[model samples]
Target: MTYILQLVTAGLAVGSVYALIAIGIVLIYKCSGVVNFAQGAFVMMGAYLTFAASRLGLPPVLAVTLALVLMAGIGVLAERVVLRPMLKAPVVAVMMVTLGMLIMIRASCLAVWGPDPLAFPRIFPDGALELFGVFITYNYLTAGVLSILLSLGFLGFYRFTAVGLMQRCAADNPRAALAIGIHTSNQVSLAWAMSAGLAGVGGTLLATLNGLSLGLADIGLIAFPVIVLGGLTSLGGALVAGLLLGLLQSFTDGLLSPMIEDLLRAHTRIYSVGALQQVVPYALLVAVLLLRPQGIFGRKGSERL
Candidate 1:
């Protein structure tokens, strides 16, 4: 029971981070009608920026803040310089450009930081909290709590804030919004900025847990399964799905992996099943897409001919 509790704790912590990142993707999609695949790159870039800031002798909090600001700027720049120009292009073309951005960010990070993982500065003090025999480190606890708080906060902002109302208007009908004097293009830019900022913070928190590395970008890929499971248009769904996926991955790593390895060793020549947890999200993604194209919380779209 204690062992199970520990796995659950770890899973929730990591899952919260996934939720945070997924929310950003949903935000961009909602406002702009564009799927930003480069979100993961934003996550990676944020962490690297934080690392760079810390190396320049800034405190941890300041480093994270600076990185977030930089990330938001990058997001706006990408929208203005890349996406805005392609407004008349095909959807597939825009998607390809986002993918290109991801590759570019990854390559840039590799050139500037090298491929080796760097030690992330301690954001939280060193310690562990034991509750019912489950040891949770301060770092993990802080990250988990912050991620959940930010997720909830962003949801509230989207539903209750003035800017959020404008954003919704723009997303629901650009022509109507424009007729009413709302700048739909600026709303799209704001969406990208906010999304990138969230991704940055998520990345920084993840770095606190997993250390800084280019592979952090790959972790961003997990957000897709999360958003899909939650429903791409549903922020609340993203939060729930993120937590669920996190728990699923954690269990696969701690319990299922060992159990499978033992079973395989006794029955076959294979010594291991590599990174089963990583495979689980994509597999789940496929299942979700096949079983429920509209997602758990997403409504089916309708069009008038």
Candidate 2:
């Protein structure tokens, strides 16, 4: 029971990060009809920026705020300079541009930060807590709570504001939105900014949990499986799917991997499952594609968010 509780807490923490990133992905897809492959790079940049800010003697709150603000500016610049000009191009071409942007952003980070991992700044109080027999650290708890709140807050904003109404219109039909004086380009830019900012926050939480490193960029790919599972057009679905995936991965690692490994060891000579936890998302992805390609929350006839 203790072990199970531990996995649940840890899963929620990691899943929160996944949900945040996936939410960003969904936003871009909705607004621009183009997946910003650079979403992961934005996450990486956020963490690195935080580190740089800390080195510059900023406090945690200030550093994070500065990082997110800078990321938003970067997002706007990316849209205006790189993506805006390509608006008339094919969707695939625009996606490729984002891919290029991802490479460039990553290269810039590598050039600046070097390849070694950095110890992330301590944002929460030190020590751990035992909650009903489950142990959780202050860092994990803080990250989990903050991420969940941010995600829910974003949802509330998306669902209950006039800006959200405009956003929906822009996403539903950019051409029609433009004809109706909606400034779809501005909507697209706003989406990028919000997405990048959310990813920055998520990245900081993840770096606190997993340490800061270039490998953080790879963690961004985890959002793909999440969006696919939740339905490409459904932001709420992405949040749910991200948490579900985190739980799935946690159980796979904590329970299934050990049980399977024990069985294999007893019956044959096999000793490991080749990162079984890591494979669960793709495995689920295959099942999802075969059975429900539109995702659980995705509408069948329309691609509306």
Candidate 3:
């Protein structure tokens, strides 16, 4: 029971980070209709930026803040420079541009930070809290709590604030928004900025959990299965799917992998199931796509071109 609880706690922590990053992907998709493949790049950059700032003697909080602000600015700039110009281009072109942006960001990071993984500074205190036989570290708790808070806050903003209303209007119908005098272009840019900032936070939290590395960007790819499972247009779906994927991956990593390996070992020549956790999401994604393409909590016909 303790072991199961431990695994659950760990999964929740990691899953929260996935949910946060997934939300960013959904935000960009909803606002601009372009799938931003560079989200992983943004995540990678945030971790590196946090690392750089920490090395410069900034506290972890400050370092994270600096990274978030910088990433938000980068997102705004990206909208202006890349997305804005390509507004008239095909959706395929915008996607390709985002992919190209990912490569460029990765190359730049490699040139500056090199290809080595660095130990991220610990923002939370060491050791775990014992509660009813379950042990959870401060890091996990912090990540989970912060992810929830940020998600709820963003949801509230979308529901109440004027800017958020404008964003929703634009997302719901760009032509209607423009016809009604809402600055759809500016709203789109704001969406990019907000999405990038959220991605930065997601990246920073992930780094704290898994350490800083170029591979961090790959989290964006992992997010693809998550959003697909949750539905492309539903914010609530993203949150649920992110958490579900995270927990599924964690449980697979902790319990299922070993069990499968043991069964294979006894029956076959295979000695290991390398990175089984990574495969789970894609499998789930395929199943979701095949069975219910609308996704959990997603509306039918939401996949607009």
**Top model by TM-score, which number?**
3
Across 150-225, the per-residue lDDT of candidate 1 in tens digits comes to 9999999989999999999998999999999999999999999999999999999999999999999997689999
Model 3 stretches astray by more than 4 angstroms: none
Q: Let me know the TM-score candidate 2 reaches against the reference structure.
A: 0.96
Candidate 2 has which clashing residue pairs, if any? none
Query: What is candidate 1's CA lDDT for residue 125?
Result: 96
Q: What is the lDDT of residue 98 in candidate 1?
A: 94
C-alpha displacement of 76 in model 2, angstroms? 1.0
Query: Tens-digit lDDT track for model 3 on 86-132?
Result: 98898888999999999999999999989999999888889988988
TM-score of 1: 0.96
lDDT (CA) per prediction: 0.92, 0.89, 0.90
Q: Please, what's the RMSD in Å of model 2?
A: 1.7
Ranked by TM-score, the better of candidates 2 and 3 is 3
* lDDT score for candidate 2 against the true structure: 0.89
Write candidate 2's Cα lDDT for 157-276 as tens digits. 889997888898999987798898898888889998999999888888889999999888876678888998999989999999999999999999999999999999999999999789
